[model samples]
Target chain A: MLADQQFLRIPGPSPIPPSVQLAMGKPMIGHRDQQAKSLIKQLSPKLKPIFGTEEDVIILTASGTAALEMAVVNTVAPGDEVLVLVTGAFGDRFVKICQAYGIKVHRLDTPWGEAINPQLVEAYIKQNPSLKGVFATYCETSTGVLNPVKELAAVVQQFSNALFIVDGVSCIGAVPVKMDAWGIDILVTGSQKAFMLPAGLAFVAASKRAWNRMESNSTPRFYLDLLRYRNSMQNDTTPFTPALSLLFGLEQVLRLFETEGMENVFTRHKLMMQMIREAFKAHHIELLTPEDAASPTVTAVKPTDFQVEALRQTLKKEFQLTIAGGQQQLKNQIFRIGHMGYCSPADVLQTISVIEVALVRIGKQLELGKGVEAAQRIYLS
Target chain B: MLADQQFLRIPGPSPIPPSVQLAMGKPMIGHRDQQAKSLIKQLSPKLKPIFGTEEDVIILTASGTAALEMAVVNTVAPGDEVLVLVTGAFGDRFVKICQAYGIKVHRLDTPWGEAINPQLVEAYIKQNPSLKGVFATYCETSTGVLNPVKELAAVVQQFSNALFIVDGVSCIGAVPVKMDAWGIDILVTGSQKAFMLPAGLAFVAASKRAWNRMESNSTPRFYLDLLRYRNSMQNDTTPFTPALSLLFGLEQVLRLFETEGMENVFTRHKLMMQMIREAFKAHHIELLTPEDAASPTVTAVKPTDFQVEALRQTLKKEFQLTIAGGQQQLKNQIFRIGHMGYCSPADVLQTISVIEVALVRIGKQLELGKGVEAAQRIYLS
Candidate 1:
């Protein structure tokens, strides 16, 4: 293996494409310069289709967690009740943010590897008549589960008027999210995921109703305030200094998105996910997430027959492929493979072949080409 | 000028060094990967001397404004009183953050072009012994005034038990801070300023006394919570995803600091400031800041000789160099030249030469090379 050629296959940050790297390496510009403002002006409209919303996507120079906090703080106040649908770690993040802000949280936790049921969400809304907001995750990176946001939104709207906010950190650009049509009040994502850039910038889009709610929010906030973001967006400037290098990479990433077409990008991610899932099945591995609920960006495998840590170590030591082990409660129980952003089906095939090699090295009894053959068949078909 | 050789001479985002830019372009790694953990471990120790503190500098993936908010929410809560020594726009940022958090702010507004006097802080502390914190800016970026922080800290400690938090966003690494020695409870800075990197990461260091106060504070916060950052630092990880590209740049930046030596770095900044200030005097232009209180990182020029906008426009259109215009109330009133981070006396001389050319173009009468000669004298002497 080349000295610096490791395959980073975590939910995020995804690998930086060569062009994006060069874009990020471009010389820094003044945050207030016209060139910078023009970059923002161009990025605003270009970013909308990815979230599938006409609302101005406010770019924040913060991690995905900060974006989640911004979403919560802008929409709700202390003493207001909110329901958080805990699909996995990221969903739990919303709960923590709400509790931190003194918002009364009612949690609906699904099984670790399963998405929240829509009917259950409606039932929770029925029970809690005064919930100010409902929070969820689009793709739980920890469990590799893709929640049915559209169906969930429909059920939520039918039962109550709580603002529907989704954390789409792992799957926003890789999957189709119709924020307006599906009635998502706020959608948040980060650059390091399917946006194919480094971590720094978080993109958040809020519906008109959410903004209306935020106008009256009394929570203590300064930097994470969405109204400040909105006011600055009107002038094509950031409320504070932005990460210019990442914004440069974002321009290139958006260009790439436009070239590939959003639909094709989603299709590519879907294909990669399917290939990896099928490969795991061929190797007699159980998936953490149900196949129907599998994330298009990441796959979590629970190897019942062998040690998950051993396989991950072998992959790293021999193949230079770094995949994520389980987080929090799922630690040491499963391994996750990320196939989002600049990743492809061909990349998935290579990963499968490498996994096959590492599996045998880890004392797993397996037919040599079984997994690779399964993945190839899926890719070609 | 070459196609992309524009000089960014703003308070921030400052011009990035070429090596730092390339380092930032390094391949993305998983946030949980050992490589990333090791990177954090290496960065943590290397960063301390810049703040002149043995205390761990918590790096947050957000702008400087977020860092200020983090500082405020960590040590104080709603209904708590604080004294904000408003030197300029950035000092006002602390007041805004305090007000946003429902903290009662007693403002001590210095004249825009002048630094806060230490006596004023002692007077405020005497009157408001119930103050939970005292906020001050080390270098007011807008008016280019460097407040006497060491004296201010001494006065605050002598008179009050309130936490002394300083915003050093525009001038931390470029100058001698001596945070621990000076008894500062908290010192905050950002990446794009004296750190010689892109705008994203914010560095904050706190005293033991500040941590103790935070333990008793009842502020509701999550993403900007310093305790979470402190907890994650023990394991060499971030509470949230870090700006990985910028961290990579930070590695290179640390190496640069090691090679140059921190004392030399401060002296370089000092010399650059003197050179630029002398150059401005040679042109008979008035400075916004007093000679002793002028910031080493940035210099604001209040010119009665020519139009500020015309000179700035000429610099951009003819020379491809960007000097910052005034911010907020100072907007269109003064032109500011940034001379921090990767900047040198030679760069300042070049800037002086460009300003001379632009001045001639913008209907100003001047002897050519006079400003450049003045800067050269200061550099050689």
Candidate 2:
């Protein structure tokens, strides 16, 4: 039975490298020790280069959602209006968080499988000049569409006072977003995605502009407050006890990212995306997002006359392949393949082979080896 | 040059066991997958026996402080009166968090090395009938004092509306905390301390009565919100991406605890504490906390004439031992020796040997081989 368990084929927690795992296995250190303070201080500078921003980055002992909440509560006060572009599920979550906090939200909703037009976002901002912040996802994990954050940032940059916060949770290391150069104020990322670690901690880079806004904002924040983090980071320690094991894992993973220049890392992600796209084309499957808007991380494929649910179930049951399904109403209509951290050409080939086999079992018309052959060609030549 | 890193000897992250380290290296699984859902569902029931509570225990991908915020914000509202019994730094932090949220705090401050008098605590509660919550720490890691939570909870029980919240971050699995039997309402623990894993996740158990208070509370909580955790726990998932690696480690560690019976775990901790106390006493050093109030997790020792800072530094330089220093004004006044987590009687002996060397270096009168001999008498016999 495929039930004995196989490798993780989902985007993350990606198959951890043996070295990273070994380092994580190292005995824990006290969070307040001088040795830990030295590690944390050294870590902040190393992360600054990956973020491409000179701003201070704070690591929190929570997931990406906690980091996102830190930005939202810090930049936008209780009564302020925030413009969120909902191109996927993560974007919709930003709206939900805002509503939960009693903040006025202006949603710029696009179709689930498409990217939002930057001009429309700019127009909305112009209409609502009093907007305190604009929120967008760099790579919408749900639809596998990359929002035009660089262009959107330009529109919000003109306001100067309004903050541009991007949820780079899924895109930070795999893609490039020059935080200061693009006028982005707050950028939040999680370790599970591109950073190639198990999901736990979130990294945030806040500009002085965002901190200025946080000075006057009061929504009763204690745990998610960025000011406390900013203050504690100066002393080279967290305000509270941190998840030491995950931090240990992250330190090694980030070191690997540094060893391989960030540009090379992004280039590798793009290559993986190109290889997947070529294989999908060979299989006669339609990709959800347009070529220019497609993310370099995950790809969503619309099903043909094939029974998508049966094919997905067969892959899991027979081949032990774990892929993602569309969320909400799109579930079962599309299956997504992830190519983020710790993924390689072999992983892609194996996934494609399983998909072809599952499709054949479900009575779908497909050449058995076409997708794998196409992916191999891209990998080798 | 003592440049290369040595093992961490502070309280936590206590050196992780080899088995626990290997457990963390496993690949990730989608939190929503049936397999993952089943794993989480299984994990919850296993935690109930360890927590000594019939109530549901919620897991958060955060440090110990995050769990504290979850219990505080969820149970106490604005303008609510909270009676905080402070014995050390962590207890002081609880008061600071309460004040930050505009909650009226009545601080019953005891000396750093002294435990709270249950009679005084009860008298204060009787004096302030409007108190909504009573906050205390089970083991004050900063000063090595263990407050009598059961006796204090008895007093808080007299006030029907007052909820008992305990920060068992440093003491949980290493000591006995009977949640239901002791009438504790909200109990929180961190993964790094006593659990013998690296820090990154917090485990919180809330009573049904505490959840009822949350339903009517008007605190602005989203990430640290217990309501969201309670809602999602019903389905065996968290509202956000949890630190999956830490969870993997936690799952294995909890199983280990169950295999060795909870009572056995408590006995081991008590034995280690007794060994440490005896070793220090043989060296003619005094423990900072009273004998009856000493925490089973860590021991705070005060030297007769040596500067605590110099002795601590010398131990690190000469021997690779890492002990904690006094907090705030207590700095250089005392050095803390932690004997929790993966520590054993042997580990305690090694630490005592280092302390003995440091004491001799400081020209204190001490017989050769006295400390180790005393520890062996308590442990080996």
| C-alpha RMSD between model 1 and the true structure | 25.9
* lDDT string, candidate 1, B71-120, tens digits: 99999999999999998888888989999989999999999999788887
DockQ of each: 0.01, 0.01
How well is each residue in A215-249 modelled by candidate 2, as lDDT tens digits? 98888899888889889999999998988888888
Runs with alpha carbons beyond 4 Å of true place in candidate 1: A1-381
Tens-digit per-residue lDDT, A1-381, candidate 1: 212236788889988876777888787889999999999999989889888899999999999999999999999999999999998899999999999989999999998999889998998899889998999999999999999999998987778889999999999999999999999999999999999888999999999999999999899899999999999999999999999999999998888888778898888888888888888888778999888899999999988889888988988876568899999999999999999998765456557666766776777787654565566556546
Ten contiguous residues with the weakest lDDT in model 1 chain B: B1-10
Enumerate residue pairs that collide in model 1.
none
Clashes of each: 0, 4
Each prediction's Cα RMSD?
A: 25.9, 25.4
Interface Cα RMSD, each model: 24.0, 23.2
